[model samples]
Target: MGKSEAQTLLEKADKKANSSGGWFSSSTTKYEEAGDMYQQAGNAFKIDKLFKEAGDAFAREAECREKCKEVNEAANAWWNASKAYKRGYPDLAVQALSQTITALTRAGRFRQAADREKEIAQIHLQETNDLRKACESFERAADWYAQEDATATANACFKDAADLHADLEEYAIAIERYEQVADHSLTSNLTKYSVKDYWLKAGLCALALDVVTAKRNMGKYASQDVTFPSTREAKFINALVEACETGDVEAFTGAVVEFDQVTKLDNWKTNMLLKIKRGIQTESIL
Candidate 1:
């Protein structure tokens, strides 16, 4: 019954939207009615668990609303479409959310756009397995949030982007992002304590490039935050850099093991350490 009703409403909406013969006959009313019909069709389809149909109906509604200059309403309809598509069509979901972001941006709702950016980023990360897209979305989200004066949220998004870049082995980009986060953290007393963590992450990425680069960046990290040099994280970074500099695989492994015993290394850290170890071994063979 619900599916039949939804299909009926969709047909009516399509006819209303497609009816021609305007010439100043005021087609705005027809568009507004068509939008209403589409919204009803979407709701009915959703009640019948026809997600794709629901999403399609909502997208049509959004288009009609946009035609009527109802920007916020159009954005809401696009958001609904994204949610409906998310259960089955992840790529379509991302596309719908992109529409939402565009509408919201045109409406000057930067914060909401930022929220949608993060949502789409997560879908890319967990559903699409597209880390590059996820990283770019996160960076875009950070820009939106920063423009909205949401400093902490922006920094967190940057950190997430940096982590994704690291996961993709794009160490230079990851290091830059980590440094951006650390630079932002340095300006706030509440966040100053976490600066060392970002610095440590940046150092690890630099170490992946080379020991000279790692040592140079670590120097910058210490200069940025005076207390960083005294932290155990800094000591570990120095030790790892030296191990890499000397082409000592055992020393690298020993340093990682010692660090893990203290701070409980995460998967990202472990993976990066493994890469560093391989580089050392490769160099030793040469």
Candidate 2:
């Protein structure tokens, strides 16, 4: 064979020799020959120290090293740390995660090592129940990923912060996050149970009933509801029981007005009105 073709064959053989243990055996250390080849390559590249070439060689060597006990410990340590963080142990989790990051760095996954560092910070801020700090960390994470134009990852962090804030009953913050979710227009992609849509409809039904029954702050309620009323709004009906019992003058006039307003928004007015009459009759019995 020609010199270049012979060299290509050697490289392929070198690659094949180094990749041992089929990826499933943690204790299988039978790839010493492959590991030696990797070490030779790394040393050869180290002489030049061209950053790209060194990095590539390091990656290949790291991959060539079988699933040694140290690598397993590193992965396990990180996994346990993640579990601990989830269970509310920030200090311990960060310590373990730090070790994992070190191990991964040594394994030549520099970027992943950096990501784990950020993850450690996030756990301390969020999983430790520090919402403010968590928000900061999440923003940092979003910024880091955004700088790389990783919109999906950035949004995921934002979404996590939003959910965390919501869990803490920070509705305003939650609303902001919800707005971010809307910004992605994920609704177009989602075809699941649609709990949000259901809740929106329920909210509209409740608001309409509140206005027709009490009439206090009805205009503001109407205005707000008008802008963002739900799809199931026309399918919902208010029984108007309290209004009937109290002989609310507001209900008598306001009910028809709101009903007309709701009807104008949809063609399902008759179905809604019938449902309301049925609801009223049910209330009459109770």
Candidate 3:
């Protein structure tokens, strides 16, 4: 009902946690008691609506559990600490969540660890606007997810990483990520239909480099997916490549317009296409 009640619980917790028992009580028993005391204090703080104190209490409990080698329990405590701190202390929340991820990884809970990594990435993206940190977390999560055979989720993370890399103008890294996802997508029947989209994105990133690189990548993509060579997307890419090689800006514009007539290009695709168009024009001027 009040802070006084929670404060009383905290005092009792401190008393219990600090006491040294006789020979009958071992160090393990003492530490476990300390952990239980800390947990009770955390819950009491929560009941009194003292969120930061509650989070601090849970973090203490997590530390105690970690010393006792109760890894999973420590991970759970760390997660609780993160959740309690998320709104008011976002940086602390990310740190606590990072601890949770590390603990879960130590427990060999790869999927759970990957999930927490994604949460950290989202926190960076939505709460902090730290694009570089977000990209790194997503990339790490994707690798872990792939190791756990979560192909779909891994691809989603990879795509997010790729998008961020492209936004940062790291085109070579973006191309690698897009192609990696496409290569994996081709192995799953459910995802095979989406490989074309991934390859198209990879091709766009390559186009940012040069027409020769784009043509080489197109050939590689076609070899991986036989039907890819016959698709309208492939033809459209080919037309753009020829336009770039010959320095024909009108042909490039016509190719984009023709493709957009039947299939709507989203803002990203449209922007990338325009960027490549500009590169070709600059080359022609030289």
Model 3 misplaced regions, further than 4 Å: 1-7, 21-24, 44-50, 246-262, 277-286
What C-alpha lDDT does candidate 1 achieve relative to the native structure?
0.92
- Candidates in order have lDDT scores of 0.92, 0.48, 0.87
User: What's the distance in Å from true for residue 84, model 1?
Assistant: 0.7
Q: Sorted on lDDT, highest at the top, how do the candidates line up?
A: 1, 3, 2
RMSD of 3: 2.9
Where's the lowest-lDDT run of ten residues in candidate 1?
Answer: 21-30
Model 2 reaches what TM-score against the true structure? 0.33
lDDT-better candidate, 1 vs 2 = 1
Ranking by TM-score: 1, 3, 2
Q: What value does the lDDT take at residue 71 in candidate 2?
A: 69
lDDT for position 94 in model 1 = 98
Where does candidate 1 clash, by residue pair? none
lDDT of 2 by residue, 1-286 (tens): 4544323433653665545546764324544444445445544544544333333333444444424445644444354434434444466556656666667656665446546656765775656756666665566666556666666677667666665554444544554564554445434445222333322323333333433432332233245345322433322223243454454435634665665675453433344334444555565566
The total of clashing pairs for model 3 equals 0
